[model samples]
Target: MLPKKVKKRASLLAITLLVTVIGIFFILKSLNKNILYFKSPTDIKNNQNINFDKKIRVGGMVKKDSLIIKEEEIKFIITDFNNEINISFSGTVPNLFSEEKGVVAEGKLQDKTFFIADRILAKHDENYMPPELKDIMKKNAK
Candidate 1:
């Protein structure tokens, strides 16, 4: 019973709504699969609501005197001053994976603060000083 102009407008609005709904659905689907949560040692220790099976990224300073490199597996401790988490990785480590450096481990948490890492990333400061050393220096300066 509507006029031609009103009918056309209704059709266009329906198509627009359908396209918007489909776009939103796909966007949410992709985000659910690709999103990863980042956690610090303190966060994991203080928060008990974290899911153990979810893949996550943990970042902190590699503990000095805690690195043990075997033929294939490497074990170390990551600390965020307030807490420390033990990590184990069985693969090639970055060239900068050494004592006193900033490292990020990607894996899933096993126990409360234990992470079974599948990949490890190491980063250094601008002066090539290890991140661990930089952290110590900053603390001393303060």
Candidate 2:
């Protein structure tokens, strides 16, 4: 038989562990809903099923000479060299956003080829390139 103090301590420890676990579970649940997956243009092209209603982030280098800035819209093509996805964004352009630069567009796909971006994120520095994007560029360079 366990002593009274020991039993009380055990119950307190169990409650602490349960509370911690419940806290973690809720945190993960919240994150799962808000998580945005990053995909390259090649990944998008190869996948046949994509949810148009869900927002996703697409990362790639902007295709050279493919940017067109109109009065109301900005259109560009992002390419991993193997495939390309056209992006249409209506928002303030980031200073780092330019042709031949790394950019990530967050939006829903109107179709497989066309993406309507609600937000555009550009690299903060010149040396910043996503590891996946770097690998894709290196594989295509050879």
**Cα TM-score of candidate 2:** 0.62
Worst 10 residues of 1 by lDDT: 31-40
lDDT of 2 by residue, 113-134 (tens): 9999999999554476779998
Candidate 1 clashing pairs, residues 3+ apart or interchain: 100-132
Model 2 backbone overlap count: 0
Query: For each candidate, how many residue pairs have backbone atoms clashing (under 3 Å)?
Result: 1, 0
- Scored by lDDT, the top model is 2
Q: Write the per-residue lDDT of candidate 1 for residues 7-123, one digit (tens) a residue.
A: 999999999999999999999888963453457898778875888888888988999899998988899999987899999999888897888888999999999778999988886
